[model samples]
Target: MYFGASASALQRLVEQLKLEAAVERIKVSQAAAELQQYCMQKACKDALLVGEPRSCALF
Candidate 1:
């Protein structure tokens, strides 16, 4: 579960839900990079944009 909130907020939510060991938070940039890499590995021509696999706007 990638949260778009502050670290403190994410922590609080995790604690509230008691999912400390189940969920992990990552930066948007890192997630985007990973998504792009996975897409490339699968040869997704439209992974990012039409005919532009490298031009991702994931952020």
Candidate 2:
């Protein structure tokens, strides 16, 4: 009975870790997307400032 309880606890811990990792991955993905958007906007604005053509493919 003790061994069974230990196994159950270990399984729960593993599942919790997996959930935490998934959450972290989602957060990182969102941050990356936001950063990409900011970069694209900055690039387009810089191009306009320098009198370059506003042909940004990201937009």
lDDT of 1 by residue, 1-59 (tens): 56578899988877978865667999999999999899887775554345654544666
Candidate 2 clash pair list: none
**C-alpha displacement of 19 in model 2, angstroms?**
0.1
lDDT, model 1, position 53: 43
lDDT of each: 0.76, 0.78
Instruction: Supply the global lDDT for candidate 2.
Output: 0.78
Cα misplacement distance, residue 23 of candidate 2 (Å): 0.6
